[model samples]
Target: MKVLNKGLKFAPTKKIDKFGVFVDLQKFKRSLCLKKYFLKDPVTRQVLGENDGWRHTELKKKSHFYPKHLISKEITTFETMVLDEMEKIQPMRSQNLTKEEKEALKELAEDTTITIKPADKGGGIVILNREDYDEESLRILNDRDVYQRIPYNPTEEIKKKFDKYIQKGENNEFLNEKETDYLTVKYPKIPVFYHLPKVHKNLNKPPGRPIVSGIDSISSKVAEYLDHLLQPIVRKIPSYLKDTGDIIRSLNTITWEENFLLVTCDVRSLYTNIPHNRGCEAIKTMLLEDGEIKKEQIDYIVEGIALIL
Candidate 1:
């Protein structure tokens, strides 16, 4: 099936529209009302019991139900509460901002000459000249070795190929009918490429950490399925550490020598540097060596990975 329209192109929003903010506010208010209902009785000012029929009934209705006593004043109270909370916290802070600071932030948001993006590593924002941002992004994208300049959109072509592959898989019994349907892309989107400035690395001319948003992309479901299949094999790797916490846990199990020196290394452009054929072969080798996956399943997994790559 055709997923995305031929003319569909991604355009990033520069500012939050009023309607979007209003919708968010309404959702927040509904959440607050639901929290109040579940945590405490709005009318009786007491905690609700687990088996409360009234609460369960209201929940089953799936409506934002409020007590009769709060029906009149609840909205006004929620608005006031939201305003007060917003006053106390900025987007990245729990502390209150001064009037001048708030005004400055409002001005910053409205400014079109600059772009604000979060740092790649730090929990901080980087404000860059829009021209510089575009120039840097272009520099990265123009690298002939990494990125190829496409003359035209290939979304439809890719979608057709993917659909054909899935159909073939179902016909050959590599995938069941249900699996074929589940893997089919309903609303595929071209992945949006953006980058976060690595401020910690260099403040003056921060290098950008490339990011490709894969939400609703043609291979998103296949990627997710492959990830699920590979996760067990990944976890079994000896050097695998899930996160910083995992590293710490692993470190604690070691008996440290006084003379030992710890060394750490970072791979430069790891993802972009890896040749697609080699990467796929590496995965295929790992799965084969593991002996847990069948040959047909391994082929399926590799094919999915190739589609994603």
Candidate 2:
């Protein structure tokens, strides 16, 4: 399912290949196929997917698929773990602590800075930061529990320089809490590349949880398509795709050993971003070095796709 734009980067879309294959990294029903292959291929030992699924295992007989990974969901649970740790601290911390432990706690406290945060039970959501905590803010924070951690307070020199970024007459603004201000919900959907065996991932342990799957070398058309579906209000989906792909490419992951096996994965939604003219162009010039689309052939490919688009 690997594909290439083939033409120069600056070339117009109408000059690329139409049927150039697209790999859907998160495709369903490919897990079993991959598992079967892994069991047979001595060089491999695992297939990846976003999560463990029965349907995936059911399809193992598909001859053309390879193992993909299934990712963990540990990231979604960090806040809960952090909160649990926070509560236990008050009792034990006030009780007896070894001299070394007390010294460590003292160092932690001295280095700690206050950060007011958003919470469900609090009054209207807001965030604040001060050089030190205030009694009013502390009482309110104590009453309403907010997510916080000891962050290094900037040195006076850094603070002075940072002042320029704020308006001269403006009240305290430009809080990084604004940047931190985000709501995250675990996606009901699974990312591709979720589960890989030790040898495949080259890791000694099942890299702990709350992680996600990732696909590589996807088409820009897919990015454009997903941009409208996923959120962040508006996201740089294309850039994210390229950046993510660049990272994976840099790692130089090898997923294939031969060509007889056809990996079947369809983009979640292939209807969008298929520019009629561009589709034709893509169907034309995209290819690998072993198989190339000549300049003259570009027109024919685009022309062929014109009807389908």
Top candidate by TM-score: 1
TM-score of each model, in listed order: 0.68, 0.14
Candidate 2 Cα outliers beyond 4 Å, as residue runs: 1-249, 252-270, 282-292
lDDT (tens digit, per residue) of candidate 1 on 45-136: 44322332111011111344544343337676776776666566543432455667668778988999988887787466678888878888
Q: lDDT tens string, model 2, 270-295?
A: 55435566654443434212132233
lDDT of each: 0.72, 0.32
* RMSD vs true structure, all candidates: 12.8, 27.5
Candidate 1 Cα deviation (angstroms), residue 248: 1.1
Lowest summed lDDT over 10 consecutive residues: which window, candidate 2? 178-187
Candidate 2 global lDDT: 0.32
